[model samples]
Target: MAGQNLTTSIIIPANNEAIWISACLEAVLASERLEQAEILVVANGCTDNTVDIAERYVKLAEAKKWSMRVFDLQIGDKLHALNVGDRHATGDVRIYLDADVQVSNRVLHQIERALDREEAGWASGKLRMAAASRVSRAYGRFWSRVPFMAKSVPGSGLFAVNKAGRERWGDFPNIISDDMYVRLLFKPRERYGVPGTYVWPIAEGWRNLIKVRRRQNKGVEQIAERYGHLLKNEDKGAFDRKQIASVALAYPIGFFVYATVSLIVRFTKDQSGEAWSRGR
Candidate 1:
C-alpha cells in the first residue's frame, strides 16, 4: 500500500488524565504529514476535567482537516474504552497510544513504511523513557539493557497494527496485559521495529514506582497462566546472565530498587480493583 493512501487511526484511552491528554493530542496533531487520519480520545470514567480539555481540541483537529472524536463514558475501564474506540476507528492503520506517552511526528510515517511490507503484521517504534530523576534514569539504563529489551520490539506503551495484522487478533480480551497479548500473537518475523522513538514517562517516587511494577508483574502472571502457548513466539533472544550482572554492577542502587519492587510484587496477591487503580 502507498504510504499516503494509508489512513491512521490513533486511539487514546484516558481516565482522569486531564493534565496529559491535551499535550498528547497536540504531539499527534503535529505529525503534519498524514494524508488522512482520525484521532479518538476515549475519555471514560473521568472524574476530573479530562473530557472538557479533550473536547477543546475537537475544533482544532477539525480546523486542520483531521477527524477527531472524544467519547465520554460513565465507566472508567481501560478495556471498555479500548473496545469502544476500536469500533469507531475507520483507518487502515490503528495506533493504540497511551495518554501519557508522546510520539515523534515521523512515527506514523515510519509505521506506514514498515506496514507497506505485506509480511509486516504488527509494528512499534523504539520506546525511550523520559525519567528526570537520577535514580529513575539509572533504573532506565539498567532496564534498557535486559536481553529481550535490547533485542526484540518492546510493545508496551505505544503500538500499532495494519488491518491484516488486526485481523490476526480481534477485539482485545478483558485482560490487563493487552499489549503483551498483541505482541505475542504474531511470530517474531511478522513484527517490525520502525526507526524513531516514543517518549514514555517513568513512574516517579518509590511508592508510585512499586505500584506500577506490581501491576506490570500481575499482568505478566495473567498472560502466562492464560496464554502460555502464545508466548513461545515472543521472538525474544536468550537471557544473558552477564548482561544482567553488568547492569547491576554499574548501577547497584537502581538495580536494588528495581529488584526490591520485583520481590515485593512477587509476594503480592491480585486485588479486584488492580486494573482500575494501577497507578496515581
Candidate 2:
C-alpha cells in the first residue's frame, strides 16, 4: 500500500435490516489481507434489532484489529446515511455496500487493492444474484445474461472508490440511483471489476420484483433528467443481440417471465419513487 491506500473503509447504510445485517457484517469481518479496515454501519430509521445486531460485532472487529461503529439515525434516508458514514470514515478507499449484500471473503481486499492508484479508479466485485422464488430466479437468470450485467461492472449491490475518485462528485445528491450516479462519473476504463464475488438477493415475488425493477428504471430516468452530462460516461454498451436470442431460445420460460415483467413496468402508470431501503 502507498500513500492513503494504507486504510480501507466499508460503509453500509442499513434501514430495518435486522434480517440481513448480521450476515452482511459476518461476511465483511471475514475479509482477508485488509489489516487496517473500518466498518461503519449506519442504521437509519431502524425499528428492528439492526442497531443491536451491528453492535455485537464490535468485539469481533476489535479482535481483528479493525474498528467498527454503528450510528443509529432517526431518519430512514439512504443518501443521508451514506453522507453521515462518509463524514465519519477514515480510509483512502471507501466501499459502499448495501446491508442485504453478502461478500465473499476476498471481495473487500480485492476491490481495495484494485483501487490503489494515483488516478481515480472505481471498482466492484462480480455480482451473483440470489433469488428464492421461481419467477424471480427466472428473471434473474435472464437479467444476469444481459451485456451490462455480464460484461460491465454493474455495481448493483456494492461499489468502491479511492480518495481521488471520490472527488469526482460532492456529497451524494437526492438521486434515485446513487450507484448509477457514481458509476457515471467515471469512464469504462476507469471502472474495474474484481475477480471476487458478492451475493445480492433479488426481490422475491412478482409484486416485489416489479417494484424493484420499476425503481431501477425510475432511477435511470431521474439521472438522465437531472444530471444529463454524466450520461457521457455510461458504458452499458448495445444489447448483445446474439446472447439475447440464445437465452430466449434456450430458456423460453425465463424469457417470457422477464419480458412480461419489462412490459408491465413499461406500461403501468408511473408511480412516485418509493422510499429506498435494503430491498425490503
Candidate 3:
C-alpha cells in the first residue's frame, strides 16, 4: 500500500443528465496533475443524448492517454449502474462521482494521492453547495456551515477509495443512500478529506427541497434499520439548540428556509416503497 503506484477510475452514474454531464466532464478533463485515470460514464436508462455527448469525449481522453467509456444501460438504477462501472474499471483507485457534481481541477488527483497509502482509507474532496434559486441559496449557505458538514468528510456527491480500501465491500447494494452506505464503511479516522473542492448543486425551490430532504431522511432510516452496525462510524455532531439560535439570529432567511424544509419532511408519510427522485 505504501509507495504504491495508482491509477484512478472515476465512475459517474448519469441518468438523463444531459444538462450537467458536459460541465462535469469538462471540469474533470481539466485536472492539473493526474498521472493516469479513466472516466466511466454509466448512462443508465437515459432517453436523451447523454451517451452521445459522453462518447464525444473519447478522443479527448485518448489525447491524454486515458480512456473514457459510456456504459449505456436500459435500466435506471444508480446502484446497479455503479456496480457495472466497478466491473469494467481497470484502475487501482475508484472514485464515485455524481453526474451533477463539478469537481475542482485537482479534486480527483488529490483524492487519489491521499488514498495512495497501504492503509484502508476512503477519501473525498471538500463539499461546496451551488444554488440557482434564492431559497436554495439561503438553504445551501446554512447547510454549508453546519457542524457535520464542516467537521467531516460529508461525501454527498463525490468519494474515492483505493484498492485496499475497497475490499471492505462487494457490489453496491440496493439502498436509498449509496453515499451514506459507502461512507459508513470506514471509521472516521480512516476517512480522508483533501484540499480540493467539488460543487454539489442544490434543488431549485421549496417543493424540490422537501422532496430531497424526505428522500435523505428515508436513506438514513434505511441504514439505521438494515445496517445498524455501521452506525458506530457515524460522527455527525448533534444539531444543538445553541447553534440553532445563533443561525436564526444571524441568518433568518437561511434558517427559516432550512427549518421549513425539515418541518414539511417530518410530517410527510413514508414513501420508501415508491420511486424517489433527488432533484427536478
Candidate 4:
C-alpha cells in the first residue's frame, strides 16, 4: 500500500474563522499528496466571510482540476459541521483539519503513510503550537506531555481515519471536545500519533484561556456524568478523589496565583506611572 493511490477527503469545519481560513486552504492546496484528494469546507452558522473564503478556494480547486466541495449548514456546533462534511465525503480515507490550522505536505504524507498500514484505524500527528505567544507555548508544552490529555492528540485539530473507522464511530459526539469522545471509542493501539504533524498557533489571550479552561471543565463534568457507570468496578473513591484534587485544588490554586501576580504587577506599574506624572 506504499504507493497506492489513496483517495483522501479533507474536511475543514469553520464557524467565524475567516481571517485564517484562506491560509489554511492555501497550505492544503499546496500539498502534493493531497492534489488528487477532495477538499470540503463546511461553513456552519458563520456570520462572517468564512463562506466566501471557502468559495474562493473551491474555485481555485476546480481551476486546478482538484476535487472540492463547499457545504453550507445551519448547525452551530463543530460536531454537527463535521458530521455534515463526512456525509459528503467520497474518499477511502477521511482527514479532519481545523479551519485555522495549516499543515505541511511532509506531515500530510506521513499521515497518509500511516493510514496505508492495514491495522491503522486512526492516525494523528504531533501538535505544535506554531508561532505561539509565551503563555500559549507553555500551555502547548505542558499539554504535549500528558498521555491522557486527548487535546494533545492530533485528533484535536488534524486527524486521518479509514472509512471503516468512520463508519464504526458514526459521527463525532456532540460535545465541547468531540475528538476525545472519538478517541475513547477506539482501543488505544488503534490510534497512532505520527510525529512532525503540527497545527498553527492558537490565538490565545488571558480571557480566551480562562474560557477554554471553563469549557474543558464543563466537558469533563459531562463525560463523568455520562460515563460514571463504567467505573463501577474500579476504585471509584480514588478516582473521585484524584479528579476533585486536580480540578478543585490544583487548578484553582494555580489560577489564583497567576491572576494575583498579574494584577499586582499591573497595579505597581500604574502607581509608578502616577508618581512620575505627579513629579513632572
Candidate 5:
C-alpha cells in the first residue's frame, strides 16, 4: 500500500468455477502487494455457486478495507466478462488473473513494478501447471522458450497492464483468443515477460486439451481472415498450411496412440484376471 495513489484492479473472469474461486480470491487477498488493489469478479453464465463465493470475497474486501465488486453476465465468454468488469475498474493499473490460478505476493509486486516503469504497457510471467503431467510439462517447456508464439496475453491466469494501454487496445475482443488480440495491439517491446512471476494451474486433461487446441485453431483462422495482410507473406502462408496440416495430422496420430495404449492396458488387465483364476 506504499503506492496508494497507484491503485491496481485485479479482474477475474470465471464460468462454472465455484470450486476454485475461494482459493483464487484468498491468494489475491493474501498478497501483500495487492492488499490495496481492487478485486473484480466477473461471473459469466456460471451454473454453480461461483457467484456466492464471489460475494464472500466482497465481504472480506469490505472488512479488510480493500475494494471488491462482483459483476454477473448471462453470457459464457471470457472476453465478454473481462469487458464488463473493465467498466467498473477504478485502478490506474489493471491485472487479469484466471479463476483457477494462484499468484504470489512477490510476483504481484514484480507485476506492479514492471507496469510502473515508463514505456511499459503490459507485463506477464511464466505459467506453471500445478499438476505436472508429462504432456503439461512438455507444453510449458516449449512455450517458455517461444514467448512470441504465446500471442494471446493468456487469460489473466496472471498478467498486468497499464490503464492507458488497456484503453489504447480497448477491451478484450469477443474471441476465444482475446489475449493474443490484445498482445497484437501493442508493439513487442511494450510487453514484458518477467522471469520470477508465475501462476500454477491444474493440468488440462486430454479431452479438454483437444477442445482447447481446436478452439485455438479456430481462433488462428479467424485472425488470419481478419488480419492476414498484417502478417509477412511467407509467414502467413506457412501459418495457413500448418494449421490445416495440424488439424489433419495431430488429432489422428494422438487418437491412434491413445487407443493403442488403452487397448494394451485393457488386454494386460484381462490376462491378469484369467491368470489369477487359473492359479485359484
Candidate 6:
C-alpha cells in the first residue's frame, strides 16, 4: 500500500479547539494507510492553547513518516484558513478535517480507494453523531435517520477531494457553510460516499444545540442567496416525504425535540458575538 503513490494532505481549520485538537491529531498520527500523508492544522484566531497543543505533535508526525505543520492565523474566518492551508499543501489528495472530528484508521485508505478511480471527484465517509445528553441524543436519533444523513456523506465534519475534484472549484468562497458549498460543487455521480464512520458530536445542551442549528441554517440561507444555481446538485440524498414521515412516526419524541429546536432557532434573532460551539 505504501507503493500506491498517493500523497494525502489533511487540512484542519481550528478556532479555539484546544480541547479536541490533540485527540484529533492523535487519530491522524495513528492512521495505518496514511504513511505518506501531510497534515496541516490551521489555527485561526485562537485565544486558547490550540496552536501549542498542535505543535506538540510535530515530533510524532516526523516519527510516523508524515509531515505535520501548524499555521497560526489572526483572522477567524474558516474559509481563509482553508485557503492558507491549501496554498501550503502539496498533496494529490486533500482532506478537509474538522478539529473536533475523529475518523477511523481505515478512513484515509477508504478515501484514497474511492478517489483512485479516474471518474471520482469528491468523497467522504458516513457520519455518526456522538451525543450524551438527553436533548442531544433525541436530536441525533431523529437527525441520523433523515434520508440525506442516512445515505450521503454529509461532510459536515470530514470530507476529502482528489486533484481533479479540487479543480472543480478553486479557493473556497467566503461562506459559513464551507462543507455545503463544496458538496454542491459536484453532482451526486461525481462524488463517492465511502462505507465507514466518522464522529460528529452534537452540541450538549438544548441552548447549545439551538445555537449550532441557527448558525447552520444561516449558512444555508447565505449559500442560497449568493449561489442559487448550485442548489441544483444539492439534493444528493434529500429526504422524501415518505421517509420523513416514517422517521417521525418511529421516533416521535426525537422528532418533536428536533423540530422544536429548529423552530426556535428559525424565529429567534441571530445572536452576534456568539462563541463557536465545538460540541464539547
* Whole-model Cα lDDT of every candidate shown, in order: 0.82, 0.90, 0.90, 0.66, 0.64, 0.86
Off by over 4 Å in 6: 1-4, 236-242, 271-279
Error of 2 at 32 (Å): 0.9
Q: Which stretches of candidate 2 lie over 4 Å from their true place?
A: 1-5, 240-242, 270-280
Q: Give the count of colliding residue pairs in each prediction.
A: 0, 0, 1, 0, 7, 0
Q: Over all chains combined, what TM-score does candidate 6 have?
A: 0.93
What is the Å distance of residue 112 in model 2 from its true position?
0.9
User: Superposing all C-alpha atoms, what RMSD in Å does each candidate have to the true structure?
Assistant: 2.2, 1.7, 1.6, 9.5, 10.4, 2.2
Per-candidate TM equals 0.92, 0.96, 0.97, 0.74, 0.72, 0.93
Local distance difference test, candidate 6: 0.86
Which stretch of 10 consecutive residues in model 5 shows the poorest summed lDDT? 271-280
Sort by TM-score, top down from the best: 3, 2, 6, 1, 4, 5
- Candidate 3 or 6, higher lDDT? 3
Q: Write the per-residue lDDT of candidate 1 for residues 1-280, one digit (tens) a residue.
A: 4434788899999999977887788888887577688999998899999999998899988987999999999988888999999999998888999998888888877876677644447899988877767666666776777767777788778888888888886678989899999988888888889887888887776666777777777688899999999989876676567877888898788788777767766786646354445343
Using TM-score as the measure, the top candidate is 3
Residue-level lDDT tens digits of model 5 in 156-218 = 367677865776666666675566566555665677676544565534544334444445566
Better of 4 and 5 by TM-score: 4
Candidate 2 displacement at residue 75 in angstroms: 0.7
For candidate 4, lDDT tens digit of each residue in 1-280? 3357877888999888788899899988877655558898998887787888789887788876778988777866778899899888987778889888888767776677677755537777777655345564445444443344433353667878776677666667766666656665556567767775566564364444444454555565676677554333221123245553454353554435335434554454322222110000
lDDT of 6 by residue, 56-99 (tens): 99999999888889999999988999999999999888899999
Span of 10 residues, lowest total lDDT, candidate 6:
270-279
lDDT per residue (tens digit) for residues 90-207 in model 3: 8888999999999999888899888888888899989999988999999988887788888888999999888888899999989989999999999999999999999999898997
The parts of candidate 4 lying over 4 Å away from their true place are 1-4, 117-120, 131-133, 147-154, 227-280
